[model samples]
Target: MPDLLVGLVVLVGAVVQGAAGYGMNLVAVPLVALIDPRFLPVPLLLIASAHGLLALVREYGDTDWSGVGWAMLGRVPGTALGVLAVATLAERPFSVVVGAAVLACVVLSVLSWRPRPTRGPLLVAGVASGAFSTAASIGGPPIALLYQHSPGPTIRATLAATFGLGTLLSLAGLGVGGQVHLTHFVFAAWLLPFLLAGFLLSGPARRFLDGGRMRVAVLTISGASALALLVRAAVG
Candidate 1:
């Protein structure tokens, strides 16, 4: 891809990541996929690793470390399993399964079907999110569900920390598998300026969002992406 186009993608992605702790994948992967779909998993993980570290720093003192730790317990094994799945599975089938799961969340939400408000349910969601995120780099839906029970900053902090660790694992795995290259790191390095700028702009916006409204918006975006994936999967 041309440098200008790549810059454009990075810019948009940075903004999305700025506004939401998790948009690096949501914003960049689709556009990058259009250019070279197989590159999706690698760049998404790298960009996510960058944003994850940024979030950890910005939200440091305010983070709920206990929650982050608990989520990681499930995430570690979940991610390992997810990465294995990605290694073994075909892209189209995997995308379809994830798409369908996301669509189910959308449908349930629209119908006013509340997520089961039990600890067991939340744990299950956490595990699912970890696995899917590790595999597809699109793990926001499960996290979105979990965050509905939290305030905005807490939600952002927890997600940033959890995804930060997950993305770290992903990058390491990709490196071991020879899926990521120095060129990709260079690309990501060049894009860091926009990522920082986005985070700066997002700080104030994030502070102003009503806690309840932010939770709802996060779920809605996740749901919309799932719907798009469903269409892509079905048609393709």
Candidate 2:
């Protein structure tokens, strides 16, 4: 039952991410954690990595390598910090912190305070993304906000590239920290089919979600999911 629930959550998250360029972790991490905390960080990172690879292939030409490089540079230190946090913090407190940060980012983005994707801002976003991603497996809003004004394809492709690489980095850090075990891979294998299904469905959904109004929907979904994470953490 837990596996089925986790699969369903990933399926939906994949579709959201596929269409919006980012959101799978925002949508899936909190929900999956609710079902089974063991499915976090590593397994979800693996699934998200696969989804990001597909997005990068589909929109390869649109990727901005310079921007990706800037973000990755920041990710290095941020990833180290995140690993330290995950090792130190308790589960519920970690969830609370991550949820609060995500909600704050969503609110800032919704207020039309987008920062241009310049070198400094991109680096900052990358660092924040890396920290949050490694700690909570919810890293997308920081980079997504920086590129909110970009073309849909560019946003999707660049984010895909960033996340694909970032997730791998996080996974490595987790492995070294002893946060990843063989069971995480087993769970990821079980959920792979659903993740692929969501990715496939995203192709059709993207046509409708690639418009200006889609930003509103994306923010709404992000905010709601963040709130859900907060509520769950508080109740627990």
Candidate 3:
């Protein structure tokens, strides 16, 4: 029953990802961690990996491969470093850091103030996304910010490819860390159908949602999620 509940959450997570071009891990990881921390990060990575691929397929012709390629250059190394750091940190501290960083990004977005220097920002965004995603399964902000300035279709396509690479890097790093196990793989597999269903349902919404409105929504939800994590950390 718990796994079933998680599958449902993954479905919702997938819808968010499909509509917003990011948020699979943002929504899934913290929630799943409530059920099982050991299982949360790796399985969420796998699920995101699946969604990334599906997204890439859906937006194949629209991608800006140059952006994705440059992002991956930073993401691959950053993911490795983040996995190492996470392996050494206590769970609570790690969660707090991840949540805080995500929240900060959200606040900045809501204010309509973004990082400058568009061309160079992608590398930094890639590194941040890869690191956070690997460490805490909440790497959406960095890449999402990068995509926010792009045309809608291109934004979606580039994010799909970029996140796909990050997930691949994460899989390799987690396997080396001894965090990837049979149970995680099984859980991810079980959640796949539901996730796909949610993504399908969200496609129309994504098309119709105005970019400005979506940004506000993303910022609001991300801020709220971050605040909840901080409160949870304080209590625990």
The candidate that achieves the highest TM-score relative to the unseen native structure: 2
Instruction: Indicate whether candidate 1 or candidate 3 has the larger lDDT.
Output: 3
Tens-place lDDT per residue, model 1, 64-134, is: 77766666677777777787787899766887899788778767776686664245654666677777886
lDDT of 1 at 3: 50
lDDT of 2 at 51: 92
Candidate 2 off by > 4 Å: 88-105
By lDDT, is 1 or 2 better? Answer: 2
* Top lDDT hit: 2
Which 10-residue window of candidate 2 scores lowest in summed lDDT?
A: 213-222
TM-score ranking, high to low: 2, 3, 1
> Per-residue lDDT tens digits of candidate 3, residues 86-200?
7788767877987788787776776767653255787887787777766655666776765665555676678888888877776786688687889888877888898899889
Better of 1 and 2 by TM-score: 2
Model 2 — TM-score against the truth? 0.88
The CA lDDT of each predicted structure is 0.69, 0.83, 0.75
- Model 2 per-residue lDDT at 113: 73
